[model samples]
Target: MSSPKQRHLLRLGLSCRKISAQVTNSATESIVAMASSTEQEFMPHYRSKLTTFPRPHRFWDANIASRVGEKLGFRLTDIGISDVEIEQPPLPTHHRKLIAPFLHSVKRAGISVYGSEKFESESQA
Candidate 1:
């Protein structure tokens, strides 16, 4: 029998593995090609859409953003939408350090981050 904390950690680890498997199975091409190819070739302009989430101000938010980006091919710059009403402090360096490992893991799994320009042209069209 495990302690509550141990059980929670097990669950988290399992979830992470599931997500990683899904991303790896769905990987379409090399990260380099995905990053450099014109957006039209991979994602049709008419079908492209931008989805925004709250600005990340915490380590957890950063983790969520990184995972979402990996799954959807959205970069940090692509998903950020400023909210003047909600003024949050900048993420601490410690939090950034915590998020780095996960981001690197996604890269290792062949997930690429895409620039905002990918969506900008789509929106214009």
Candidate 2:
């Protein structure tokens, strides 16, 4: 007979396996949706990137997977969306705006520069 903690660990591992299966299936569906009707399609390889990382839902670890799903334009599965809210990127508006001009200046000096005329046209468009 296993200890309570051991039993809990076993359950958690099983749950992770189930979640992986679901995500893999979902990925396969996504690939099918994107594939052309007559084209040979590649199999979906849904690697469980979150398994090794600490479970975000338990005791409120940050929801990295959830954020990733959001960025990828997918719904976070029940297992993916943890109780904890993900950490948000800081809005360094002043610093970002200051750096923006410098970055643009550097880009303008490069071979692939979007020159002043192109920039003005694009902005207008």
Candidate 3:
């Protein structure tokens, strides 16, 4: 059974397949860029600004999704899990920059970096 959100998206003319194709094309472009560069070329050189850590759940869900997608060779959207929204506080800009390369690599590897700021913004819109 489709979730209400999924049905709503479908009703609005964005089918899952269309969404998947769009995401896949965007990911392919990034993957191609990544393929031409070494890891060090893409990673930012910055010191982490985090002085305190929050509870694990704050980051655990996205981390787990990335890892599982890596292992399974499928993004969350690949298996109709697109509507599972997770809300998280925005990360500091420095933190985002520090992890941007890692997240890019994850996406390049065919995993969805869920709960990212981009996703959050789009979901809210």
Candidate 4:
């Protein structure tokens, strides 16, 4: 579900498209250029995400965090969680067993651990 702001923006976009159709060539050109430039500024992020993972949900791993941080012009440490650290899932399967003990210790120490996948992207800001 989108926020009210997002819904408003979508409405504004629809209105803009209607207006653009009735606008002069120069006005249309300007609007098109502005939209293109905005897209270009955000292109690196979109491309990196597209090439790295099929969806944002894949960021459950530390590797994705590092890659995403690099693409977003930020440090992996800035996003929290070390690339070497892995979170154990709720059920300790074969793969989860590898990190289960470590996660249990971290939890017992009262340290909070989070994955990028569970949170919204910075772009939303």
Model 3 residue runs over 4 Å out of place are 1-87, 114-125
lDDT of 1 at 85: 13
Winner on TM-score (2 vs 4) = 4
lDDT (Cα, tens digit) per residue for candidate 1, span 1-125: 21222211000111211212112111232121112112233233212322225523322333443453343333322433111011123343443343344444344444342232332233344
Which lDDT tens digits does candidate 2 get at residues 12-76? 01122121101212223221111111112111212333453654332211132222223222222
In candidate 3, what are the lDDT values of residues 15-108, reduced to their tens digit? 2111011122222222111111112321221111122354232222233333332332344334543332222345454333423343443456
Candidate 3 at 108: error in angstroms?
Answer: 1.5
TM-score of each: 0.23, 0.17, 0.26, 0.19
As a TM-score, model 4 comes out at: 0.19
In model 1, what is the error at residue 82, expressed in angstroms?
A: 25
TM-score, cand. 2 vs. native: 0.17
Residue 71, candidate 1: C-alpha displacement in angstroms: 9.8
User: Which ten-residue region of model 2 has the weakest summed lDDT?
Assistant: 6-15
The count of residue-pair clashes in candidate 4 stands at 0
The candidate scoring highest on TM-score is 3
Full candidate order by lDDT, most accurate first: 3, 1, 4, 2
C-alpha lDDT of residue 80 in model 4 = 35
| C-alpha lDDT of residue 67 in model 2 | 25
Candidate 4, 52-120: lDDT as tens digits: 644553212332222222332222223332322122234323223222332333333332334423222
Ranking by TM-score: 3, 1, 4, 2
**lDDT value for candidate 3?**
0.30
Please tell me which model should have the higher lDDT, number 2 or number 4: 4
Cα RMSD of predicted structure 1: 18.5
